[model samples]
Target: MDWLLKATTPAEKILVMFVAILLFAGVMAFILYVSEKLPRWIPAVGFLLPAVIMLAFGLLWPGLRTIFDSFRDAAGRKSVGVDNYVTVLTNPDFQIILLNTLAWVVAVPLLSTVFGLLYAVLVDRTRFEKLAKTLIFLPMAISMVGASIIWKFVYQYKPATANQTGFANQILVWLGLPPQQFLLNPPWNTGFLIVIMIWIQTGFAMTILSASIKAIPDEITEAAQIDGAGSLSTFFNITVPSIRPALIVVITTIAMATLKIFDIVRTATGGQFQTSVIANEFYSQKFSQGNNGIAATLAVILFVLVIPIVIYNVRQMRISEGER
Candidate 1:
């Protein structure tokens, strides 16, 4: 009370009084609104309207603008009428990026999901199953940047005749082979990045598949055993089929994520050594190179790639729900 009375200036007292009055009014207003004043949709629209407008602004408008920009020139000053698209599709570097992206889209999702599914099954019944799953799932908690840094150290290069520091090179040296730079190669270097995505994504797939596996009825396994089906046959015939829906979800989710992979490439190689994919290239062109049209084209391409996959996943989920 002494501190409150210590303000010499009348403006300070007024300012403090204004804030206290504002707070009191806000509390009263909230209570009144809860009692009767505000409309039912006020709160609903208050939150959801922003999100909806944001979707339209952030995602929808940008996507449409990108599609429009794809027709323009690099400078974005004049309409080039598909010139940017043609150049992107035809250029050898761009073609390599497209191909690398395709390889990532295909290989990472397939291999990771497969490995996850297999591991989920392998560890399902064991006493250490939870611990094993946790160990495998651990990588997923690390951000792509953190994982990239971790793997970067593991793949770091060193000159020959020097003590090899990179894990890959150190292992090679241990085996009496020459040290190798894992991030500097052309085609194989792409796989090194892909491996990181796989390591991160596998836990997600495994957790999903593990749940689906557990959801498989105990009676079904017993029935398979009664039918004299071998363990392999039972697994192949029962386990795989029962979890097909979850497998689809895992595969398509990973596939979509694989398309958007920029961090791994950016952090590991800075999109160098012919390793730039569409996402990284999008950033490189628009921001770094100031080629807005080509960047927009790349963005549009990514949008086109993602939309259909998402639609398919939603449809598959609905179908699975219907079946259940």
Candidate 2:
């Protein structure tokens, strides 16, 4: 049992993993054999028992433990009650993290969905539609860390006298302006990081919304044209309404992703200079600062904040299904 928790070497870890897998396979084999011998109703229960047990141990136990830890002190020995939660909610530094998170949640989804919708509408039936959509969606194909690194170079700052390597600062230099420190500043650095997320998510929104746009019946657009509607009129009145469900789904989905955004912030700014969001802050608290209680509290807050968005997303999906 002690060895199970002490498998630090690569070979030891691999051996432990193999043993776990072997044990899992044996248990599954035994369960299947016993299930075949059991009654029909009992067999269904037998088949589900393993999955239920796994869920309990894997998800339920960890969640409960985190919640329990949130009430403890940083040392994990003394009871702190609600102090961790109170500090997270009321402290000025933590408030900045919360505000930065709020900004991310608001900006990323709205801007991504808007840009995606506009691009989808513009390229809906154009000659280079596939190429255009592909260009926008290529960022989504890249990992967040990769995209962040790419943008990092784009925002890289150098002395005004020195030759600029960053694309963004080069543009400023070309225009006779000084190169700005994009990642060293507060508030604006957060905004710059948010842009990376928007850049990545726009492709997903465009893909989903584009498919939804094409599903619009040509008859409706033709009818609007017959009624003397302009392009903007038809787009706003006909095209948008047609993709309302998809719009909701895209916005809510992006909102959820934005809430849990860690990679972009971590890679681009390392969550410094007041650019930290909930997920990044959680990691900093747990690992760098070694404040387990605050980390757990942040996790719980993140979980609670995400619940409404998830519920709304699920409800919208169900309604869309019902309408279909």
Clashes of each: 0, 0
Residue-level lDDT of model 1, residues 1-324, one tens digit each, is 543556567887887787789987886566556646456766665445556987999988877787888888887789989878888899999999999999999999999999999999899899999999999999999999999999999888788878877898888888988888788889999999999999999999999999999999999999999999998999899999999999999999999999999999999899999999999999999889999899989988898999999999999999999997
What does candidate 1 score on TM? 0.87
- Tell me each candidate's TM-score: 0.87, 0.91
- Error (Å) of candidate 1 at residue 67 is 2.0
Q: How do the residues 72-191 of candidate 2 rate in per-residue lDDT, one tens digit apiece?
A: 998688889899999999999999999999999999999999999999998989999999999999998899999999999999999998999999999999998989999999879988
Q: RMSD to the native, candidate 1?
A: 6.7
Candidate 1 deviant stretches above 4 angstroms = 1-47
Q: After superposition, how far is residue 88 of candidate 1 from its true place, in Å?
A: 0.9
Clashing pairs in 2: none
What C-alpha lDDT values do all the predictions have? 0.90, 0.94
RMSD for each of the candidates: 6.7, 2.8
